[model samples]
Target: MRKFNLVFYFSGGGQFACEIEAEDMATAGSIAESLELRLSGCKGYDLYVKKEDK
Candidate 1:
């Protein structure tokens, strides 16, 4: 398993970020997608996932 940093770039001018644990970066991205859909509401946003540095 690995740690990932999830960043959501919202269109409205603010940002949301969090850390999650997943087997790989892809899994982390999937998790981010779910979060984006549910959390972003009607606002547009871009999701980005990066592996956490040791």
Candidate 2:
């Protein structure tokens, strides 16, 4: 499995924030899903996952 760094930017006005680190996209998606429920009410919450470079 590949490692990835997931970044979630909450729209509004704030610095870039890292959300989670996962083994793969699937895991990252799950993490994001959980976050979405918890973070509900905040506008423009977006999730992004990118593989870590070796």
For this target, which candidate reaches the highest TM-score against the unseen true structure?
1
Model 1: per-residue Cα lDDT over 1-54, one tens digit each: 777766676666677777788887678778877777887433543444554568
Clashing pairs in 2: none
Off by over 4 Å in 1: 41-54
Show the colliding residue pairs in model 1: none
lDDT of 2 by residue, 1-54 (tens): 544454444556543456466776777778766776676354434556554568
TM-score of each: 0.68, 0.49
Model 1, global lDDT: 0.67
lDDT of each: 0.67, 0.58
Worst 10 residues of 2 by lDDT: 40-49
